[model samples]
Target chain A: MKEKLCSLQEAVATYVHDGDVVAIGGVGRNRAPMALVREVIRQGKKNLHIVGREKGMEFDMLIGAGCVKKVSFALVSLEEFGLAMNFRRKAQAGEIELDEHACNSVITSLRAASMGLPFLPLRGMFGSGVFEVSKNLKEIECPFTGERLAAVRAIKPNVTLIHAHQADKYGNVRIMGSPFEDILKAWAAEKTIVTVEEIIDNDEIRNNPQLTSIPYIYIDAVVHQPKGAWPASCDSYYDSDIEEIKAYAQAIKSPEGFQEYLEQRVLSRRD
Target chain B: MAEYTTAELMAVCLAREISDGDRVLQGLYSPLPMMACLLAKRFHAPNMTYFNTADVIDPEPKKVPFSTAGPALQERAVTYIPLWQTFDLAQRGELDLIFLGAAQVDKHGNTNLSAIGPYEKPKVRLPGGAASAHLCAIMDTVIWIPRHNNRVLVEKVDFITGQGYLSGGDAREKAGIPKGGPRKVVTNLCIMDFEPETKAMRLVSLHPGVSLEQVKEATGFELIIPSEVKETEPPSPEELEFMREIDPKGVRELEFH
Candidate 1:
């Protein structure tokens, strides 16, 4: 088996190119690859398009860093804290293109991409006004029943990044809790990078076959970085830093505070 | 008189709306409904199947979850799902009830969670439609508003994130949407229900200290107020105690504040 281990910076630099369409795997605040995302920002890549099913801090941080040009997702709020400040401001300022899709439609697009299909038929958008705005959505009549269905375009991202609980030396990933589109995202993308909380022996993976959510063949690279999902919860490991997130929400409201946050938190990284 | 906070009142009102054996679902930023669904499951509707948006099924968290999407909800789950499966269940019509919040809602029950001002250029770019637009057309949705004011209760939403009763009765059916639609709108001020014939919002009851004039003044559109509107019943002592036990740390306070 090929050795796929790498440093967070090396992994990001090798896989995430500027203007590349990138899909990230996490829901709300669960187990996000913030370390890798921060590194992407540190590399100062521009015009990146982000594909997320559900996100919060990671996307907001990336947007605030002036890295994103377009975003396609169901929702991107800080949950209990408040709205995603940078995402909201940048979008309202017309600095980034917001391709809004319902959470289900985004998932359907990923499913289609994973299945290598052209499009997926869905029933949710029949009468909804979303079709009027989202040009990529089309109303097609089912050939068999003549029923109108929304044909959501497939989402095949150039690269996908995910944070897992554990991975083996050969890159088999074990996601303890709800996989939440991470596996599907990995399958759909052209390249897959995983940031894990721990790098365990292959025997541990072999000993527990059922916990293997992503097989080694699918993963392109693996970076062992504990607390990779910091500020966000990583299931069994730690809970989300609600206070810090709330503080970030308040701090990012002002330009000076946001800059200070970047200086203290992002720019002054030890590793 | 036993005093109750607005959060407790809202959660209790939402709990009553749930029926026995209903397959209910709730998303992120919804603490009231999470508590209500759990309360309903514990007391009135034990058989109610609950989805906590954390992908957990019937999550019996020892403590109140800080956020609905947090991992704490899955502490003692019977089973769980991938986030995609939640939508799959909604699309297949397996989900019976869902709780939603609206940035703006109209008399016709049309809802907007997408943008505040306009689609392309918004005064405030609210979070885009996650599952609101799609789920509302399929399931029996209940709208919850944290604050009730004229801006939120508009005559017509700027963007329709979820289709309530579009124009009126039969409009949803005419538009090829599924039969079930929005059933209620629970807010801090009062509980409102949709009219059977017109599909317009009608004031059912007002919370304690909330006057009829206040509700009327707060609503942007004209409401169908009954001649003898009743005061909303306060939460029972037992329900309040149970809620306290469920959310001992008062996680619901974070939103109301």
Candidate 2:
């Protein structure tokens, strides 16, 4: 018999662990798993490390909820209107240990891990400041040309929390918008969990097999949550709510404002 | 000749330089030239390929910033391919165009994105470099430096985030990269190309609103502006409307980071 599927809270609860690196999918205010983020807040997750790639809203929510202990990312902005106030304050205050990695390096490391590779050859540090932090890169001589190149270590995640446009009961999912670095993260993670806008039939997926990006076997659990990818646009499904994003940006800057904001939308009103 | 906006200046570069049907790869946040390349594909050559860092290849790429037609973009007729496999395409010399941005671009086309003014404690920290460094050596890359001030176009970048013109294709070969160095450099004020023999940069054309003095003064190094600078074209009525209508939800503003 198939196991019982649960709510967004239960789904995220089952996977997250303290001090674990989790990759979140969404950009600024679009397609982030806000419902589950609320659950993280409710649980009061501690020592959680977040890996963000254009995942502004979810990161802010977790920080607002005091969930993340450390963060590694490229850019953490609230999509255009302004700064990720709460996140910025936390980082500046040394509340969270922040390791600012380059966007391509993070994704490349994840991509290498996803492919089950030990490391990847990288050359993104040519004319930039990112080259400094990456001095740890190991150099090896290439067999083909004998030219030495640096290898960036792989990035493996403890868990992957992805929001998709559609998914099947079997766990195959469709990412309706920009994949960002989601595919690479899926490979790098030990376990993958997803919140999807809709659940479709496996037969439907089989009928049109190519559309699926997240293969079924990799998924540990799939939660059917509508509007799950909020803040981030899900193609034609929905446009991002700008007012909500602005409110989030404002709320994150101040603890009182953020707590009040979260209490009003997420904690006070039940999902 | 009419005065051209920055968008048109970028478009003129692409239309004039990119061959009739060369595969072009552009990364995200590469706005000005990306818009230009897409416009070229729509108007000049349909066979031209378009690839986004998100990994969609030649997608009937949605005009909207966040693509709505994700599934349709991967359909058979679209020649949808793996995004990471793009490196392979460049390795095999299948790419002709690649659009990139630089925080600080020097006379040699070297780019910097490490620190602001100083090495450790800088005035402003910028987002570190992306694949521009790697891609710079692979494809017929085009560098876009939107801010055309001396600080941005310097005599030498503070750090080499991406190489501009390799000593030559010989340096690229020694490095095991099959392709060559950057073919052109696109800026807000003027367009530039390398002096092949010495690998020095030479000015190709200046944007309409920009003057010879402004272009020369803005550059960190002495430039060889052509005797006759052609005016850049203006955005079509359609292009202007599209820029406004889509992603009105602060899509443009969300790019501060």
Candidate 3:
């Protein structure tokens, strides 16, 4: 085991690489891994793909930092903070491949990945336009239903980055607010990087099993990073810093402003 | 005239309309109307049965957020009814009323949820038909509300989320729908019903203080406003208080949708 103070660059370099599908946990403004994402951006990994329901600063940084090549999201806006200009403009401009979606599609997609099944069977989509949107989506016969169903396929990512409330040095993490579908992402990935706001002893978390969100067995590295979910919340630990989020929103509205943001927070950082 | 945001108006709508005597079902994230149903039951509908044809309807109410439950909702509540049950309820004609929102609706009540742009790749994508398509096929009555304007009340939906007003006379029966579809559309601006022949949405009523032209301006589709259009009744003082105070979290809608 190695113990050393790591910059954001060193921290992100520990998990990500090119051509990886990343499963992220966070909805609206709760439970995100912003610091880790900042590290990923600062390190400049490439050809990344992301899957999730809500797209927060993590998605923004990935795209803005020129690391992401594709994204599949249920809903990727800031909700009330404003629309997602980086993702929206990038998708519209074709800089990144976008799969704009609904819950059934994303959740089914994740489930299929976990089951190692080729497709997911569902009712009510024979003639609907979703058939077209998902035309490229693999279609197959549901083994049990015998009816034709769509397979979301296994989306094993190279890494899954998550921020939670507490963790032991061994990587067992506890998430307080919303887990969104993170456990599946962990199972669907090759490796995981768990960062936490607090670092507790493994024995303590082991004694009380209910507090655990990520069991240590699946985790690769455990990093103690407070305010790790900077733009988002860590639940019982911290709330979203709306002021910083507001500033990020203001910057992403224009390319010039976004570039400035990248330079100031991303490029300027030693990490 | 009050300071009720769009969200508050939606809460009031749920509280006043849904009754305890009737079982209520709603869509997820459909905050205002769902709240309105709870209030209506708490105040009016006393014995109403609640159902969520989509997700598990959690009655405990604390862990689930006011708007929509995250993954944690599964932890607290038992998965109760399947969507087919709501369809069954509508099929048996047991449903007193059901509320839903629409992308676009035309005269004679043809609603679209297919594409926001062309049929190929739409500009905007919404959560596809929940029970709208089937509900239209069998429901005794359905209320369509769109929070936004003109783009929604178009002469045609870039896509149809659900097929509405299949046929006023007997076309629905012939098509296999026991009951005809679509009773009314409650929008942010005003209310509308179907015409006799064309079956297009006719302006039937407006929210309090809304004008005829204002409703007309918001509609992309041509509408027939009845000579005598009424206003949606305002929330009673009691309804307002319950919504703002007791159910501020918007739980009334969460359990059923």
Local distance difference test, each candidate: 0.87, 0.65, 0.61
TM-score of chain A of each: 0.97, 0.91, 0.89
Candidate 3 ranges with C-alpha deviation above 4 Å: A1-8, A135-149, B1-7, B14-148, B159-185, B192-204, B224-230, B242-257
Instruction: Give the chain B TM-score for each candidate.
Output: 0.96, 0.79, 0.78
TM-score-superior candidate, 1 or 2:
1
Q: What tens digits encode model 3's per-residue C-alpha lDDT throughout A55-173? A: 55678767877888988764565544555677766665668776543444565566666776755543322322334455435546767867554445445667888777777777777
Candidate 3 C-alpha error for residue A163, in Å? 1.1
Candidate 1 matches the true fold with a TM-score of 0.98
How do all the candidates rank in terms of DockQ, highest first? 1, 2, 3
Where model 2 places Cα greater than 4 Å from the true spot, the runs are A1-4, A26-34, A52-56, A59-104, A122-132, A176-181, A201-212, A242-271, B1-4, B60-63, B66-82, B117-122, B165-178, B197-200, B220-257
Q: Quote the lDDT for A268 in model 3.
A: 86
DockQ of 2: 0.22
Task: State the lDDT of candidate 2 residue by residue for A1-271, as single tens digits.
Answer: 2333467777767888878888876544555667667777777778888886544677877876788887766556553455567766676555766555555556666787888888987643333334445543555677898655657677689998877878888788888666655666776899888888889888888998889887876787888888776655564587767677777777766789988988888777655
Better of 1 and 2 by lDDT: 1
Report the poorest 10 consecutive residues by lDDT, candidate 3 chain A: A122-131
**Residue by residue across B108-153, what tens digits does model 3's lDDT show?**
5656644466644446434344345445544534554545467666
lDDT of 1 by residue, A143-228 (tens): 99997788999989899999999999789999998788889999999999999999999888899998899999889899999999
Q: Model 3, residue A189: displacement in angstroms? A: 1.4
lDDT at position B154, candidate 2: 80
